[model samples]
Target chain A: EADIYQTPRYLVIGTGKKITLECSQTMGHDKMYWYQQDPGMELHLIHYSYGVNSTEKGDLSSESTVSRIRTEHFPLTLESARPSHTSQYLCASSGTRSSNYGYTFGSGTRLTVV
Target chain B: AQTVTQSQPEMSVQEAETVTLSCTYDTSESDYYLFWYKQPPSRQMILVIRQEAYKQQNATENRFSVNFQKAAKSFSLKISDSQLGDAAMYFCALRQGAQKLVFGQGTRLTINP
Candidate 1:
């Protein structure tokens, strides 16, 4: 298994609450990604980081923001949680530079806002 | 943007039989990468196989192999002697260089007893 780890495997929070999804990797990979996937569906790239202090939004329009402070950790935060934010968040890391360098994905955090 | 298409929404095969999942991608770039990922009920995305566009020879790993046709823009996976463990949702994805991946909606594979 990849050394990538994501905290809060599942989250259920009230609307208007602030939330942070934590992702970490011990492999010292230069690339990190966050994907949002609904139940049994395609994975949508929400955010990605090339390295520390560099983050970019993916093709999908996402309200969440991400920061890459340290090489090992990339955390995503939401200002205010909403029902539209409810979905499975997957954190992944790639060790190599190949376009298809097979991302090592976490078990994922299934979030439900009510 | 590169786009991947998996025409089959669902597929099934008897245990010990062979099954194939189809995938096609659209890309103007000559160099790129292709991948097939297996997501079980656990929801962890596991890479089943990959093929580089530069390579003409197909890539194979154990019972899993990819039929990559760069000219035709097709990449498919064939599973031989399918097992119960092979049941999962399969995603076909495309990537340009070392960038983000574009994935298909996925195909659910069932291994019938």
Candidate 2:
């Protein structure tokens, strides 16, 4: 079935290490988003892309950046990861007419920066 | 700007019983959409139900249903026949036009057997 996927479900790294979280969706949706969520807390949008080559920062300030190189792929990168950057990263995609169905989300990547 | 709120941080219900999760939002736009998403432990978040602001009728999916009071800026989820699988984090979300979706603090639902 067509669904969104996130790689490296759990990751632990030393502080200052550079890393990239992979996100891909096979649903051919035009809108993709990245959200940061602390355990048992509300999710906050960090980045979003309307389509290929289009990206924008979200409401919450984030040190990470994202790029939409392809319709199905939206990856987030951190130049130097910090303990504060550690959290669950969720990827979601929505179709052009998403009012009816809303968004489809990936399992999420839990990163731990020590 | 829009804001979504889930007053209840957590809720509990007995198996095979019914429970309601409250949600309220503030938006100036008349035309918009409301949705309830469920995130199970270590699992992906999935849309449980959606409601269009213009639709007067409530939205329902199987044992999941929504009580939408557009005028009052309220949208609540009602789960019937609660199951163990229903125990999860439930989030209320809102989207207006091309704006980004806003999410409320999730309510963790616990189903007691």
Candidate 3:
């Protein structure tokens, strides 16, 4: 079955630790996105990509950065994690946001910085 | 930029009953799309249904349906014959033409015994 995957369902780390959140999809979608959400809040888009090697910052400015070296993979990284960076990171891909189908999301990575 | 709003912080429905969760949005563009996504306790965001701006008829999936009042900028979800599995957080999302989606604060649905 085609699906999106994220690694380390939950993570807890100390401040200043380098962390990477992995995201991959079996579907050959060209558009991929990264979103951050606090508990019970609206998800905020932090980064997005149109295709391989193409990435753009999203509506919400984020300290983390993302890279799209392959169509199926988009990874987000924090050079130095902080308590303020603790949140749920969600990965999604879509054919087109304008299309009726909308986006397919992963289970997400819940990070806690202590 | 588009914005979505889900006024109800939470809602409850008895098994086999029906419940509706309200959603509203603000957008300058005339053409857009609306979606209802379900996030279960497992934390997977699943698409429940979608509606196109050009379509006058509302969208439905099994026990799930939408009441889309485009002129009023309101899109609400109606779940019929609610089951325990229907208990989840539902998010209302809006997309303008071909951009990233704007999501509302979710509405947590609790199915009571």
- For model 2, how does the per-residue alpha-carbon lDDT over B1-113 read when each residue is reduced to its tens digit? 79999999999999999999999999999999999999998888989999989999999999999999988999999999999999999999999876678999999999999
Pitting candidate 1 against candidate 2, the one with the higher DockQ is: 2
Worst 10 residues of 2 chain A by lDDT: A94-103
Model 2 CA deviation exceeding 4 Å by range = none
lDDT of 3 at B103: 91
Worst 10 residues of 1 chain A by lDDT: A95-104
Candidate 1: segments with Cα more than 4 A from true spot: A96-100
Reference-based lDDT, residue A31, model 1: 93
Model 2 lDDT, full chain set: 0.94
Clashing residue pairs found in predicted model 2: none
How accurate locally, in lDDT, is each candidate? 0.89, 0.94, 0.92
Models ranked on TM-score: 2, 3, 1
Interface RMSD in angstroms for candidate 2 = 1.3
Q: How badly does each model clash, as a count of residue pairs?
A: 0, 0, 0
Q: Across residues A5-112, which tens digit of lDDT does each residue of candidate 2 receive? A: 999899999999999999999999999999999977689999999999999999899999999989999999999999999899999998887645788999999999
Q: How high is the TM-score of chain B in model 3?
A: 0.97
**Docking quality class, candidate 3:** medium
All candidates: TM-score = 0.94, 0.97, 0.95
